[model samples]
Target: MFAPGQEQLSKEQIKAGEIQASQTVRSAVAGAIMLYLSPFAVDFVKKFL
Candidate 1:
């Protein structure tokens, strides 16, 4: 069994870990979207002019 105050501390640790993971996912997705769009955007602009 966990010590008296350990359960609360464990919960906080789990929450912090989840938040960090979510932030990482968001950043990666944003970066990927930008990378994927850049080439298409440039091509479109080149053709439009």
Candidate 2:
């Protein structure tokens, strides 16, 4: 009865948490890639300009 409703709520909460964790990881990876590549990009531009 009421137990099923509570269980569904818990499941939804777990899914939301997982989605948030994935987004955070993706952002961190994107930031790291940008950080690593930015210096090379600047040097390349400087050579042309």
Candidate 3:
């Protein structure tokens, strides 16, 4: 995508971006999983309280 005068990301910068994206995806997945399991948490709390 880089043309003659356009700025391009260095290899380290590209890797860092990829890592950040991966972490973001993982965090989203974890949040969704927690949401899906939230009912169980409520149930567990009810059992003790």
Candidate 4:
């Protein structure tokens, strides 16, 4: 028979994996947005200083 604790542990592991995957996707999107916007930001800052 499977141990009682094993099922809970497996569920926790699946939840953790989903959280990690979502974070990874969010980071990728943020990075891409920053990459696309950086040039305009740099020019804007340069105009002030």
Clashes of 2: 0
Per-candidate local distance difference test: 0.91, 0.90, 0.97, 0.91
In model 4, the Cα lDDT at residue 47 comes to 100
> How well is each residue in 1-49 modelled by candidate 4, as lDDT tens digits?
2776554447788899999999999999999999999999999999999
lDDT of 3 by residue, 1-49 (tens): 6588888889999999999999999999999999999999999999999
Runs in model 3 deviating more than 4 A are: 2-4
Model 1 clashes, total count: 0
Candidate 3 to native Cα RMSD, angstroms: 1.9
Best by TM-score: 3
Per-residue lDDT over 1-49 for candidate 1, one digit per residue giving the tens place of the 0 to 100 score = 4676554548888899999999999999999999999999999999999
Top lDDT: which candidate number? 3
| lDDT at 7, model 2 | 38
Candidate achieving higher TM-score, 3 or 4: 3
TM-score of each: 0.64, 0.78, 0.80, 0.74
Superposed by TM-score, candidate 3 places the C-alpha of residue 43 at a distance from the truth, in angstroms, of: 1.4
